[model samples]
Target: MKIDNEPDIADFDAALLLVMDAIWSARNVSLAARRLHRSQSTISASLNRLRELLKDQVFVWDGRQMNPTALTEQLMPQVSDIIASMRALIWRAHGGAEHAHRRFVIATSSYVTALFSAGLLTRVADEMPGVSLDFIATAPNSWTKSVLPDIDLFIVPTNVARTRGLHTARLYQDAYVCIGARDNAQLVADMAPDDFLGLRHVGFSSVPRLTASHEASHWHALGITPNYVMQTPEYLSLPAIVAATDTVAIVPGRLAQAAMRDFALKAVRPPVPVPDLEIVMVWKPAQNDDPVHAWLRGALVDLAMAFDA
Candidate 1:
């Protein structure tokens, strides 16, 4: 079969490319529709058009399953590669990382900000000096709703699951550790669970609630209840407060490590097992193919891994 050499035939069509890519990734019409946020009928209609353009049945039903035909199987890898190359070319044309002046908005918690924003910002400044970053402190309940539409990326704890139409990748896992002033008398080798419950706890309550229900749940399961004397939204400020007074806070090991230098804090393993913190980077599927976004995501994952290492 002779391939069309017309310029129009060579030009990329984003919509068709997306449909084909989705179908390939999903392996089913309904699943593709869900991923693409299109109705099943709409996806089916698009598939029909794709079949005519590609001159192949592409996918066929085989006992309640959509199986790729031999033509599709042969074309799949090439088409996918073409789509990826086209996306890179488009991003390059629009000024990629070297020349791009794009602003990346991120929705994340203050705790995460304390742990990563400094390192990430420093790296970004050195690499993409023209690019700007806007960090918004996202509340637990309002993360999905409050994230800016123009947000390039969002980093949050794994406890916050991704909504439909979003792509998430786990960056790292952290565990809760008890942080206290280094000079605190309670810094002993044999610390008991009751010792933590008895101490005046400085709770990092980003919201109005005095107790973190997740932490409470873990403690409840262990038959331990923290006696929080004061609750504050800012983890950064907690170090100063704890430095002045002998209050302890249950915080992520990363945060504890970051604050240790300034506040003379010691990181001790929690007596009760707290849920492991899964840091995830999330973004919209629409931006998945953007070269700059891909670079930024890759850089972040690398940075996180390096930090962990």
Candidate 2:
């Protein structure tokens, strides 16, 4: 049976709603066209259609800007509500985030994996036990659209995850510290820049070197490079190697703190100061509206906030 007084929307479309809202917010057809990335003529056509549907002038040109008509001013609240409800429905699909049962694979650098794994695992287990997560080593250098199908996220240093077209959000900031055996004679609470540079180093080169941009700039400014004795693709292995040899490694502060108790190691400030490293969470724009994936992203972002605290 047909429901009575159901508010017929047979002729309405989301594009007209968006055009109406955009024009209202912008107060000018040309400005609204720019905001919506449409030509002014296109916006005018949509506006004409909206006028026909509502049977109102909708707006009036007041010399400087478009002013909403009395009918439009009254109807806009409902229009805006409709748009908001539509977006909420889109984002909250699939029974919302908490109830989603999905597997997500994230490609991340070793330092990020080591630093966040425990917290992320616990969060998923506690909140959404059905959710499964996997972490794999990030690709060496290819941050392209072709790799999007393989991974849900990329947790890497901002400089390394620099896919010009992908979406990126700041995860956390960290600084590099020098780690070595506690008994190493050359290790000190604070050493000279030359002393620090002169020591043999074990470098982390998983995502184009942990010294991606910020630390690299420091070395460049100092006019010297760390004398690397060895290199590894993961940060977790650095502690064991440093504990067994005279060679020291430069690592993220949080990783060094976590590794110190597991290995007989001590962390000291690097002799040369470097800017804080910006670690970011990156994902394909196509996944932006996926509720299950957004849940995982939210979990990681929350963990990052607590880690920074």
Candidate 3:
């Protein structure tokens, strides 16, 4: 193989700039260390390395604090501009779900992540072979603002997607079911509305407080408040937790199905009827006709429709 003149990136950890920026702004080793959540010793070490690299004492203690040298002042704006330009380049070139590599990013609930993992992974393996996937979180109530303008797809509640004026198409219709440990003595085939309310529950909290929890907000409308034993932001963790405890939780039917098959958990229809959880995939108009996005969307829609069967 022919030798290449490109410099080795291993020695040039750009992360040094992060420390440099902190040190430059804070103007003190101790203060910079605190602001960057690093130890004073670490900041000092970087300062030493930076001095060696630039052949200048970037900062020197002058009676009180470490003051930036003349060279340091000159380097600041140039370094700042370089970092900003790099970030802008990365953001502008590949802002959506599809990366230069065949990787795709999907923004959804963790429950959705678990439920779709096997099927989606299988499809990618069989069809898109070398492709990779990333699942970003969809915040509880702020699904639209968070998922849109960044991701290629938004798998979220249909009405929420529509209300936000996102370009949306239905994926599947589902409903909530109460899930509990298989060994729970109180769990039975039929649970009354009061019984549902009385049962100690584990909650799926997408954000802080009850507002982010769909199950909690829906129940609140019915004048029902669960005795939440644990409120977890991660939905995948709920199955293992519920399987080991007597706490019951209202989860989407498909999510309950996936968990029941995997864990020692049981599910029963909630006494109070809930509106069908019509999940949809929302995207920008720009991706409407994009080929890669279309293929991924088609695969997802097909997988979701299979859930219905």
Candidate 4:
């Protein structure tokens, strides 16, 4: 066989290959145009271009039926292989969602889970029906080194920002706001700075070894310690506790919105300056180039951006 040395073929444009495949399968210009929902003139023009590029008449009319010539026969197998490979390449590039049966494991806190459960999961289910999700909550320190081989992604508060070998993106910013019982007489008016200092407060603290700095850190920079009546490790319980008791708690705005609907709670601007919490999505650098990971990350960031709207 003579090797036809030609300028490198532009990577087969998938659309053009599909058109060629349609013509090959139908074996008639009118039939292929009908199958492709295109005009016969358009199909003819594309075939002319294909013939010019390949330097061979790929198809010819033999009375009523279309026939392949010797050159076309030689190229048929290669063309079919190229078309099949191109189909798989497109599917994989699109994350193989149509046939994906893989599971994705994510490390995240309960608060993050609660915030994204409804809307995020619904989108995931609709787009990737064959994929399953697992969310694991890990403590700040342990999460740094706890590498699960199956964990495809990590969603955590940006406070745990310094993870080695991970790519991170800020999903959303959560600001602190004071929440109080809707019926509380003291909360009827805007809370004075001193009122915040005087009121019994509920806080969430999981770590041992609490110091004055720890207690005052969330408050204003002046370092006035809050009078703590109760402290719990679970942030989810804060809404219930504040609803039953007169205790006030500073919580993330998203949680405060959720709590306000369930409990008779009013969200107020915090009396003290508190740092804004950034929720971030993270994954191992090795997975950064994975098509599925990129799709999931884009979906998450898109969801987070919708919250602001």
Candidate 5:
């Protein structure tokens, strides 16, 4: 394909650019093949064609990994731009989401999955049958620049989104609620601040301290610390732990609501007012103008609004 206005550079095509981009992003032929959903042999053939057309060794295996050559490094930025533009054009020409087919990898917590996955899946199945989502567990430091490119999106709290300078859109707002065993008498409807602090706590430690601190800002303002007897990375694990012990955990209101149905849990309003949790969808700015990404973002925002309704 002749990118830009040059007529003599027609040796490349859309497929070649896609192969180059996948290989450049993955650095492994097999991984690139998987990303493109093509056989490894097909990817190798495309790579060979790319090398021949460009008259340069695009990538070289340096014992441990495949390294992009200088020419490839210089050309990748333009190649990526071309690919993105081509995708946007195709999306508009092929009727947008109805015809779009790709698996999106989203890094998120189980809490988000529980809150939004079902509705999202149903929507995708109905409106965009060719689209699929893979929700992967996120880590405390998953917002780093190095990790942003591997996934299409991140559903995280506002605090976590600030760690990286990426594009973000608010999904929903929720508040913290204190949860304890359903049979626990300490979980009174109008439990006092002192009474709430008296019980041991279970903390979700998968995110940065900022999120935890924000959740417990009221206690911090009052110069008090909840007795934290346990800490776990997964939020879904807290219900079982809290149900078995006298410890109470501060979790999102929706999480508490969902947990109460599965486990013998009771959620009560926190004694002190806590900050609202603003869950947002985060993505790389590089994908800001891509039509398919924009459509997906719009769909997610719509679903989140409907969920709140």
Candidate 6:
């Protein structure tokens, strides 16, 4: 059932169409490649396929840039609506993960990752099967769009989130506690400040703590130097590592409780007077209005509630 002057869309690739749109807007193979996070060769291959299928010179290159052919200009609006329709159809199919078939990026610290990733994974499996989560331990430079365009969420402390002036919601505030193997539970539990500081500590830190922040400075002000026998940039791994050995750690209460179930670990009140750490989920200004993203944020808030009272 071919119309007189219309080409069959069956021959056209849906993904290639998206490439066309990117190229049309960017008007340069290299620029479009950067925008799409693809290699120039990849984009060129799609453009070549598009030209062969459409039987039209989509874009003719001028000395400085590529200019769209007349037919290409005419097809732009119709193709754009089609792309939108395809995206909407996909979202409707899943309905739960409104941004289904899409990948979302999150930049966070190891501590926050340890706190929320498990809950988020469980929720995603049950509710948003079509959605996926990518957790990066290094915090993105949210100040610049070009620097980290793919970043969808930023898990940061309340203070840092406040400074961004971006849309953010507080997750939870977890107080610091002393954690240690149950075999040596007596060493940490009911220990005095002097004894707490003297235990062989297993330190856990991510990139954010490389240069001491206010919290570290506060610890130093009290002349509390943890006798760290081992230090690693792994937060979740700390539980298993410390649980397997005799080392103790001054860590968040939530992590300690979680580790208790899997490993023979125990949490005790830190005698050195620890501060409560408040974590927040920061929405990249650009993705703040996305319905699925907003829904995900709500789910995250719910997950945070499960961490502690």
The lDDT values for all models are: 0.73, 0.78, 0.72, 0.71, 0.78, 0.72
Q: How do the predictions measure up, each by TM-score?
A: 0.70, 0.68, 0.62, 0.65, 0.64, 0.61
Give one digit per residue, the lDDT tens place, for model 3 in 20-126. 77777777889999988989999889888887777789888987888889998778655644454455345435643234346677878888887787898898776
Winner on lDDT between 2 and 3 is 2
| RMSD for each of the candidates | 9.9, 11.8, 19.3, 17.0, 13.3, 16.4
Per-residue lDDT of 15-40 in model 2, one digit per residue for the tens? 89889989888999999999999999
Tens-place lDDT digits, model 6, residues 1-309: 788867687777788988888888788999989988999999999999988888898987887787899998778755654565465445546664644665678888776776678888888788678788898865433446574566788787665553344555666787877777888854655668777778878776444435243345468778778777776665667788878888887677777777788998777787776678888777654565365576577677778886555
Worst 10 residues of 2 by lDDT: 205-214
State candidate 6's TM-score. Answer: 0.61
Q: Give the C-alpha lDDT of model 3.
A: 0.72
In candidate 4, the residue pairs with backbone N, CA or C atoms under 3 Å apart (3 or more residues apart, or in different chains) clash, namely: none
Which scores greater on TM-score, model 2 or model 3?
2
- Residue 116's lDDT in candidate 4: 78
* Candidate 6 or 3, higher TM-score: 3
lDDT of 1 by residue, 29-65 (tens): 9999999899999999888887776677888878777
The pairs that clash in candidate 3 are: none
Candidate 6: global Cα-lDDT? 0.72
Query: How many clashes does the backbone of model 2 have?
Result: 0
Question: Model 1 — TM-score against the truth?
Answer: 0.70
Candidate 3, residue 139: CA error in Å? 1.4
Off by over 4 Å in 1: 1-62, 66-95, 144-150, 220-223
Q: What's the distance in Å from true for residue 251, model 4?
A: 0.5
Q: After superposing candidate 6 on the true structure, give the runs of residues whose Cα lies further than 4 Å from its correct spot.
A: 1-99, 140-146, 160-162, 207-215
- Clashing pairs for model 2 are none
